[model samples]
Each structure stands twice: as structure tokens, then as C-alpha cells.
Target: MYADVTVVGAGPVGLVLAAELALSGVTVQVLERLAEPETSMKAGGINVPTAEALDRRGLLPAAERVHRETMERMGAAFGRKAGAGAGAAATPSDGRGAGAQRQMTGHFAGMVIDAGLVDWDDPDLAAHAAVAGARMVPQRELEGLLATHVERLGVPVRRGVEVTGFEDTGDGVLVSTTAGAIRTGWLVGCDGGHSTVRRLAGIDFPGTDAELTGRVAVVDMADSSVLDEGWVWSSRGAYRRGPQPGRVFTVEFDAARRDDAENAGTRPHRGAPAEPVTLEEMQASLRRVSGTDVTLTALHGAATRWSDNTRQAATYRSGRVLLAGDAAHVHSPFGGQGLNLGVGDAMNLGWKLGAVVAGWAPEGLLDTYDTERRPLGAWVLDWTRAQAGVMRGDAKSVALREIVAELLATRSGATYAVKKISGVTQRVEVPGDHPLAGRHAPDIRLADGSRLANHSHAGGFMLLDRTPDGAFARAAATWAGRVRSVPDGTDAAGAARAEPAGVLVRPDGVVAWAADEAEATPTAVTALEAALHRWAGAPAHEPVA
Candidate 1:
């Protein structure tokens, strides 16, 4: 309607997609039902991978203002267990339940630190001191920052507006909202787990059934000076003995038990406007497990319902309408990958959407969005499902967790998990006999007093190492209007690998082609031409219906 792209829902995911599109000069509109960002601390942490994505977009500094503060507080708690003189009360022994013992017994037992931020001495860490590691920004703060970033991009976000319906007109779609109707060439649904846009598109989210369990207490009590870190308290059955532990813990709350106890109704009733649960009920649950009176100043009510309904949509696109974030896939939040996964989807789609809108992409380029992301979404769903089972104390899940944990004790295993979960190991449509194919191009320092790392948002095909040969150089000259290249002398390792004298990289930072030095100059030129075609380097004027 008023914009080229209409984004449904103004949550963090939608805001990111909108900001990215608008930054690339796309006319974008974001519709949100909420009048403003929420104050609830629904989400507690952002893992390492998300921090990298934020850093790439240069939002890390502003994000750090909040992230660092929250992380510092979380870190203090986590560190207490590892700190000297930290007693068993602060630091529980290397404790394992059926699952933890089975999966991680004999595995390296040590304090866990953020892998992405592991190398504190790294130069980049020192340079970007503001956002150092997995930021601990609460859900509300994250939304606020993202919303502000979107507004600064000149994109208009309409809050308190709900999308009612839409129809595809073959060329564009007419989106009807509670506010008004608008027409847009494209749409992205980032409307969370229960998505209205997804329903309108008629996509099926099929998978395993959901697992419902747990009642949670979110108390804002005077900080328990003794308990700094988050801990789970457990007992033989039902409620634990006495006072609650710290401010957070997951306790089983069944409907039957609530009916038996006066204060243990279906939902918690604190002093809030909502129903209230007595401080005694909360304290008693904690005491049964930790044997302590976890003092409380304020109490917030929450309940947990885990679903194994690990789901992914059959497709991410339907003509002009598309989906991202929880709208496309959902899994248990055990590993805290839900938000990060959603953010990654937006990042991956953002560049492609820009290319398509700018007329540089082939017709099938948009098709790759579903092909690439849907599979990954499915994969993450599996991982989270497995992890969820472990969290819920399943014996089989515990055994599998222990096996994986044991394997992960090795350097190779840890590195593999680190890369996989970090989303840096992502690969896309790279077909060839080349060794670099299907692998992320390791960031290499160039010898030419320049580095590929120096480039900001280095989207599109990048020639990592270029040739000095006249024919090879001439080939690059031909694609000068399309790809960007640097001389091979820039990096020694890249130069050594240079045959036609350089390498071709994809927009997602994967190596596409590498030249063999033994090949003839003609062969090198031919290779360049082949790569140009493979990467859709033809002029943007190429017609598309």
C-alpha cells in the first residue's frame, strides 16, 4: 500500500526486518497491535550469535549500553559459583540429574563462559568494549532499542494497528488492517508463534505434539544477597519444602494440586492486578528444594507450558507474502535459540529482499529463501527439541545429552557446536569441486595492507584475491560493473591459493570459486565467466515478470 514492503507485527523480529529494508532504501511499513513496547521481562538473554549480528549492523554500541549492564548483573551471579570462597551454597557441586549424569558424566566440568566472547584479549573485543558478549538485555529493552532503530530509518511503524486480511492481485497485495488498507509488492510475517499472517497465507505448521509443564514465579524481591546466580530447585514430588530459592525457579504446578491447596490455584496471585498467590505458597515450594527461606520483596506470576510441537512451516513464501521468525518455526525455548533464530532469519532475508527490490536478483533468487532457511529452521527445531527433553528430565534425553556433552568435551566437538549454533557455519547453493565450496570463508588477513574484514556489510560477490595476469585482470574488468575484487597480494594465504589468481565469494560470505594457478590464462577467464553466470552478474535490466 503506502510502502513497497509491509511488515506485520512490530516485535524485535519485525523491527529488524523493517529497519534492514528501510536502510537499503526500501519503502517499508510495520504494523503492530501493541501501542508500545512491553515492560515484561519475558526474554532474559541474547546468546553470542545474536550479538554478532547486532555488531555487524553497528547497533552493538547502543545495544551494549543496556546489554552490558544486564550481563554484568547476570555475570556476577554466574561467577559467584566459580569464585574463590564461593561455598557449595553459592556453587552447587557438578550436579547431574538422570539426564545430566547420563549425558555429561566424565565430561569436562568447569564454569561455562560465552564462547563468542571467549577471547577477551581479542583486538575486536577491546575495540568494541561496549557490547562484549552475549548481551543480557531483557525482552522489553531489546524491543525498545530495535523500535528506535527502525524509526530512525525513516520507516513508519503504525502501532495499535492489526492486519485483518490481504489478497494477492498477481502484481502486488492489498493488505487490510484495522487502521486502513494499503498495497505493497511484498510482505513479511514476523507476528510471533500465533501468527495472523501465517493463517492468512494458509501454511501448515506440522510437527511433534507440545509438552505442557511448570508454574514459574517472577519475584522482584530485595536481591537475595546469598543467591546471585539463577538456579533450579527440585524435590521428590510436587512442591519443594520451604522458602523459594532466589527469585526464579521452575516448579511443577498441576491443576489437581492447586484444587487441593488454598493458595495454589491454577495461576499465581501476587499483589498485582492479576490473581494473587500467597508468599507462603511460593516460599514453601523453594524450601522443599533448597532448604532456605529465599526472602521476597515483590512477586510476579508466570506459568510455563513447553511444547514439543517443534514446528516449521511447509514454506516461507506464498507469492508476494512471506514469513520470518516464530511465524515460520517454533521450538522449546530451552536453549534460548528462538529469538536468535528469528533474528538470523531476518538478516538472511534482508539482503536478498534488497537485491530483489533493486532489480539485481534473478527470479529464482527469492525462491532460495525458502530453500535455505526452512531447512535450517527444521534443523534448529530438532536441536531445541532434544535439548528441551533434557531440560524436562527425560531419561532418554539425558542419556543423549550426556553422550553429546561427552563428545563436546573434545576440542573438535566444542568447536563444531560453537560454529553450528553461532550461525557462522551457514552454507548455501555452492556447487563445484572446489575445496572452498560449501564452507564459510575463514576471515583471512590480506598482505596488501588491506583486509576483507575492513568492508562494512560486504554484501554481493566479493573477489577475495585477484590476479596480476592480464587475461584474469581483463575478466575482472568485464564484471567491474557487478563484482568487487582485490588483488591477490593482499593476503598471503589467499595468494598461495590463487590459480587464476583469486577467489569469488558470495554475499553470505561463502567462497564460490577459486582459481588454480596451474590453469592457463584462458582457463582462468573461462572460470570467471562461469562464476559470473552462476552468481547472476548480468545487468539488472534483465527482465522479470
Candidate 2:
């Protein structure tokens, strides 16, 4: 098969990127060894940034609805509010929906943020942000949703097709898979930690080694009541057993005992006996970690083991081959940010790759993918690594956990955790002096009462004008096919969230540039053109000077 781009792996990240490129009218193909979506939702959480990315693609409402229904039912079952569950959904009185809520609480390493101590909302900053909280959608279902969406966009995804190898011919990439050979302009490895594409491209997966092995399972318990529903930390280890009966999750941080099969080693047996795990072994680990008699009756499916081992690719790209998701980085899912981070990687890389493949992106635009995203990957790696230090059930770790929990209970302490864990604090560096520059633009309400993101479903830069002067419009017209000029209900500069006189939003929803509302000097117009040239490439006809 011949395509503009070939996405390796049919997981959520790969599918999202594929759909994104396809939506931009690019010919793309997805290759995966898994013929079908896995029945088990391996990942159960997605952060707010990812939620916003999905929203921009017009994919969030349906998934959010599914999540809301799930939460509503869970709320009924758990006797809690619809939005009280982890990564839950809540209806807001204002236009921002859940993103507008005032106070929220999040847990970091067994410690819950104290809402009374911390504002959680951070009103001053929340307005300009995209999403307020996360959505607890399972990986299996998320994959299904994205797969279906990509298919609808006319992107063909070939399952059970393992990408064995590839060669970057200095012009295009030649991909070899078990099914056959294919040609594409670019290839992205969205495969998991053990990525074949990353290996073929000779990228280094460097980071700290695993300090502990965490185990989880899906089984019928003899006495389910003994298993705790949410998260609980003890002298032994940490776990979150329920909120769904028979879907048991456990963790024991003892890398020392990983190889001993009797000790409940790492990785699942995939429901097969002697994949080096047993029901007896899982029960033992549970008892040892939980210090409870939570007996296992029958093992339905899971006997998987995970680790806090963190690794990241030295770089995100190798010639025509690029990496995303676990292929780019791997960490323990302790903070439940794996799906969120991977999805964010897709959002960040998708637009730049789409732009480059479409021939409108500036020189080195594709290079920025590695420059911008790799740092975020490294930060998350450290974030998860620090969480691991808090999680290990040991003398020092327990004492440290106590201190961390105490600090997290304070306003200053909780704010720090909430921002980082929620994926809310990222500000990718872009050229420009405006504080809003290089940040994800706010969800601004436009003149027609529609949100700014609504106009971005079709790709291209967006110029939201607040000034009466047609200067920005004149500038945007230079990049006719590249930038779309639109008017907002309020002045773009003084709009709801400290907006500028004008805002140039990248197709990926990042604020490329912001005009100073206070000044419309010749300098302002000149600055605007410079911003356009830097981001949107050189203007056509020099604005007919």
C-alpha cells in the first residue's frame, strides 16, 4: 500500500494521529499486530489536556457522554456525586462545563489534596485553560472510539500487520511488515514500550531501571468486601481494588523479588497458566501487600505485573521515523497519566506532522516535534519516578509518604500537585514576548456564541480579531490558504481570559501570537506581521506593500 504517512500500532495514540492527519486530507494507513481492540480496558484514565485535544477534534462529546453515563451509574452504585469518581465528569453552570468548576481535589501518592486548603480552581489561571479535569474512560473503549473515527475518515487500518522494519530512503520511508511492504512519506511508532519501530530506527530508550514490580488482576474474589474500592496505602504497599467488582488492582514495590515466579513476577500471563503466575501467587501478593485476607476464587483474565521502571527515547525522531506514546517514553502508571501523556503526544505531533506533510509548515517545523514534546516526556518521567519514591512500602518511603501527605494537605502543596498531575501547567516555548504566547489558547466564546475551538475542526491557523482596525485581517490574508480570520463576540484582547487585541491560534490549539490590546501603533502591526512570518511562514506578496 502507498500512503502519505504510515502509523505503526493501532492503539489510541496511533489512531488519534492517523485520524488527525486524515482529517487534514492526508492519505494515511495504520498498521497493527492486534486484529481487534482488546476486551480489557488496560488504561482507565485520561487527563484534561487529552480531553481538550479530543474536544478540538469533535470527538470528546460522545466519549464524554459515555464517561458521564458510566460515572452516573457508578455514582448511583457508590452513593457519590456524578463527578466524584476519578477522572469524572460534571455539568457546569457556566459555558466552560466541567472546566469551569471552582474547587477540585486530586491525590498524589496516596495523599488527597485538601480542597479547603487549596482553591483547586486557581480562578486567575483556569479561565485561559482548555479543560478542568480528566475523564475516566477505559483504554479498550478509547481505542475503539478512535479506531472507528479514523476508519470513518477513510484511513485504512490494517490489523495483525506487524511492522517488522523500515528504511528511510532520504526521500520517503519504506516500511516492511509481516503482511507486506508499504511506502509512505513518514512513519510514526505509537507502539508500546517494546516498540519495534523505535528499535528499527535505532533510538535509545534510556532511563532508570525498575525498582519494583506492581501486579493487577481481573478475577472473582471469594470475599470481595475485604478489597478496598479506591486507593489505600499501607505499610506493605498500595492498591485500588474496586469501584468495579472483580477488577482488582494491586502493587507491591519489591524489584528484588521480581524474578521469583512464586513471588508473583512482572507482567500478566494473559489468562494462560504457567505464563509464570498463578492464582495462589496473586493471592499471596495481595495478602502480603494489603495485609488482608482477600481470597481469590477464580482468575477470569488478568494476572499482570507492572513496574515503576521509567524510560524515554533519546529523541522523538530518527530521520523519517518518529515515535509517540510508549514508544517515546515509558513510566509506571502510578499517577494514571499514561494515556493522558500519550494522547497529548499525539496532539502535539499530529498537527506539526500534518503541516509538514501538507507542505505549508515552516522549515524545521517537524524538528520542533522532538524539541517541544521530548521535554514534556522527560518531565512526566520524573513525575512518575517521584511518585514511585513515595509509593514503595518501606521504612523511609512510608515516613516520606506521611510528610508528603501532610504537605499536600496545605493550599500551596495541593496546588502544585493538582497542576502537574492534571497536565495543566505545560507551556511549550514559542517565539514572542506575550505571556500567552507558546501556551494553549483559552476556549474563547466567539461573536456567534460558539467556542473558538469549534472553528478549528477544519485545519489551519486561526486569527481571532478583537480590534476594529483591519490590520490583522490584512496580514492574515497574506497566508490565505494557511490562516482563517474570524471575529469574536468580545474584544479579542480583553476577552474573558486576558486575551490580546488579536490571537493567532495554531491548528493544534496553541496560541502562536497575541497582539497587545493596549497598543495599535505601527509597531503593533509590524510585530503582528513578524509573528505571522515566524509561525505561519512568509506572507504572500508582502501584504502588497
Candidate 3:
């Protein structure tokens, strides 16, 4: 069989990438090694950037419904009011009340950053005000949601088809799987860390060794009262009580010691072991971290192991072969950055790769995917590494945690942390001096009352023209086939904020160019024309009907 793109791994990232590619008129298929989706718990929530991406695709409502159902299940399991004790509580000093803290933006190490302290009034943060905040949707539910969406888009997801190998020909890729072989124009590895596709493609994944080992599981305990209700740091390590009843997490900082004994001097084991985690092992780890003999009667599902073994690929692409999601980078689950980072990679790369396959990509367009996303991946690696350092059981780390806690309590510090954790502060390095340039476009409300997000559901570039005479829209006509123009309407609140007269927004919601003047001058129109060529490629020979 032949396809435009063959995505290896049917997880959320792969599914989202498949949907994006299909929306861009590219034929895509997804392959999964597992016959059924795993029920293991991962990424209990998604951050702000991921939430906005879902919203852009009209998938947020379904995701929100799933999140509500998950919360209700947890509430019933905990035998408490719905949504109680699910996330960090608001500090009395911040004074935004219970409503604000419920958003649960993110945490550094185990220190939960209270959402109440975030300065929404900050000009830098204004973009997020229109978009939804973070939501608590487990990984499995998200995968299911995206799977349905991808199927509706007419993309087939073949199960039990393990991609054993592949060769990237100059023009296409020939994939060898357990089921059979298939040829495709492009191959993307959205598989988890230890990806077969990455290994086969010979991409370099270089980074730090593991520092601590952590285990999370849902267990029935004979006496659960011994453990604290939230995260507790001790001299040995740290442990967390319920975000859901019977859900326990423990981390032990003995990785270096274990590595020294096992590897002698080489690198420590980079990921979790292949063997299943036994009941005895869970009890022992709980005892070591909590200093309490909590007897685990039984494990409900599979127990998973993780570590702070952060790493990123040297590059994201190799000929017809490329990488996204966990296949591109790996780190500890701290700050809940892994899934969000992967989703961002897919959003940034999907449209570019689709353009490449569709024969309209500008020169060096696919290269920008690496230039824009690799640094973000590198930042996340260091971000998780920093959290790992602060989470160490040593006295120095404890002192450092104390300082970080103090900083987290202040307004400036909380705002900065929330900005980073929510991903609102991340900006692409696209060339432009406008404040909104290279940044995620704010969901501006047009005069017709339709928001910018309403126009982005089709997965195409947009020229939001607020010019009184539709000057910018007229200038962008040459690229009308590739870019949709919304003219003859003013931004409902753009005037108040002194927003640009016209702005060019990419398929992924990034602002490519903007005109600050109230009217589009000859010079401004020329710049807009140049941006269209740079991002949308050469204008179509005939204007789109």
C-alpha cells in the first residue's frame, strides 16, 4: 500500500499528526504495535498550548467532556465531592479564591504553582485570556478521542502492525513491518522513547543519565492512613498521596548508586525495566520513600516506572524519515511537560511536512520544523533536569527547594512560572519586529462576532485584515488558494489593544506577519506579499474562486 505519510505509533501525538496531515489533504495512516490501547496512567493533564491546539481543531469540546467524565470517576473513587483534592489548593494570600486555583496549570518538581497568583493582566499573558486553560485528561482518553477524530478524517489505524524496520529512499520510504511492507512519501516516528524507527534511522539521542527512579500505581492498601494526603519530601525521597484514591507515587534517589554498582562507570539504565512491577516491589518502594509500611494488597492495572533521564534528538529529520513526540525527546514526567512538548512538535511539524508532500512548501520550509522545535525540546530537557535537581533528597536540594518555594509564592515568580508551564510564553523565531509576530495569535473576535479560532478549524493559513478598505486582503489575493482572507471586519477589541491593522496567521496559529498602521500602505502591502511568498510559497497562477 502507498500513503503520503505513515505514522508509527497510535498515541495522542501520532493521532494528532495524522489528523493534521489529513486535514491538509495528505493521505495518512497510523500503525500501532499493540492490538489495544494500554490502560497505564500517563500525563494526567495537558498544558495551555496543547489545549489551544485542540481548540483550533474543534477537538477541545470532546476532550473537555472526557476530562469531566474522568474527574467524576476519580471523585467517586475518592468518595469526595467532585473535583475535590484533584490539584493544588489556592494560597489565602493570592486572593483569587477557589475558582482560579482549580485550573492547575503545572508544578515544578512536586511544588504545585498556584494559578491564583498568575498575573493575567500582564500584557505578555493577554493572549491566553481568550483561550481555555489547562485541563486534566488522562493519556488513554485523549488517545481515544484523537483516534475517533482520525478515523472520521478517513485515516486508517492498523493495529498489531509493528514497524520492524524501514529504508528512506531519496523520494519515499519503504517500511517493513510484522504485518507486511508499505511504501510512503514520509515516515514519522511518534513512538515512545526507545523508538524502533529512530534507532533504524540512526538518529543521535544524546543527553543525561538517570538520577532517580519513580513508580506510580493504583493499589488497594490494607492501611492507607499512614501516608500523607499530598506530596511529602523526606530524607530518603518523596511520595504523593491521592489525586485519586488508591493512586500512589514514590520516587527514590538511588539511581546513581545502583548505576555505580551495575555499570561500574558507564551510563545508568536510561529507561524502565522490561519486567513487570510486582506487588512486593511496590510495597518496598512505598516503604522506602514514605517511611511507612503501607501494605499493597493488589495492583489495579499495570504499574509504570520512570526516571529523570532527559534526552533530545540531535535533529528531528533524516531524508524521508522524521521524528515527533516522545520519539524526538524524553524526560521525567515532572511539570507534565512530556506530552505537551510532543503535541507541540506535532503541531509545528505537521503542517510543514504536509506542505512538503503537497508540493507547495517553500525552500527550506521543512528545516524550520527542527530550527523552531528542537530548541523548545532542549529547553524542556533542561527544565525537567532542573526539577530533578531540586527534587533530590540531598540537603542541598532541600535548601534549593525551599528557595524555589519562596519564589513561587510571589506574584512575579508565579506569573513567570505559570507562563513557562502553560506554554503561553513560547515564541517562534520568525523574522518580524511586531509584538505579535512569531507568537501564537490571540483569539481575536472579528466584527461578525466570530473568533479567530473559528476560522482556523480548516487547517490553513489566514490573513485577518482589519484595514478599513480591505487593503491587506486585496494584496494577499495572489496566494488566496493557500491562505484564507477574512476582510471587511474590524477586530472587536483590537482597537482597544492597539493591535495591528492586518495579521497573517499560520495553520498552527502562529503570527507570521503583522501591520501596525491603521491602513495598509504600499510598503506594508509589499511586506505582506513577501511574507506570503516566504510562508505560503509562490502565489497560485490563478486566483482561487
The lDDT leader among the candidates is: 3
User: What order do candidates take by TM-score, descending?
Assistant: 3, 2, 1
Clashing residue pairs in candidate 3 are none
Regions of model 1 farther than 4 Å from truth? 42-49, 60-67, 75-145, 214-218, 221-295, 299-308, 394-413, 433-436, 439-441, 446-453, 458-461, 469-482, 486-488, 491-505, 508-528, 540-545
lDDT of 1 by residue, 1-545 (tens): 47789998787788888877875567898888767654432455564446545554556556656744553444464453211221111121111111111111110111121333233233222222222332555566787888787777777888888889999898888989888888898888888766778878888776655553333456655545534343342322122111223335443322222121111111111111233345655555555544556666666644232333467787899988999988888665544567877876786687678667767766676777787777778877887666545443346544665676566656556545544544555556556776556544544435654335344343445675444444454465555544666655424555443333566765544567766564336665677667766565464343233
Overall lDDT per candidate, in order of appearance: 0.56, 0.71, 0.78
Cα lDDT tens digits for candidate 2, 1-545: 89989998788888888887886667898888777655532666566677667667776666666566656676776778876745444553234644433334456765666555655457434653444432656676677778778877999888888878788998999888888888899999887777778778978777777777676677778787886677787767777775544566677766534332122112221111234347888788888878888888888664566676677888898888999888788877767777777887887788778878877677888888888888888888888788889887778988998899888877888777777776667779887788778777766776566777777776678888766656677767878877888865254455433356788888777788887664356776777777777767766545566
- Model 1 vs truth, CA RMSD: 8.8
Best by TM-score: 3
TM-score per candidate: 0.72, 0.90, 0.91
lDDT score at residue 354, model 3, on the 0-100 scale:
93
Q: Between candidates 1 and 2, which one is better according to TM-score?
A: 2
Worst 10 residues of 1 by lDDT: 98-107
TM-score-better candidate, 2 vs 3 = 3
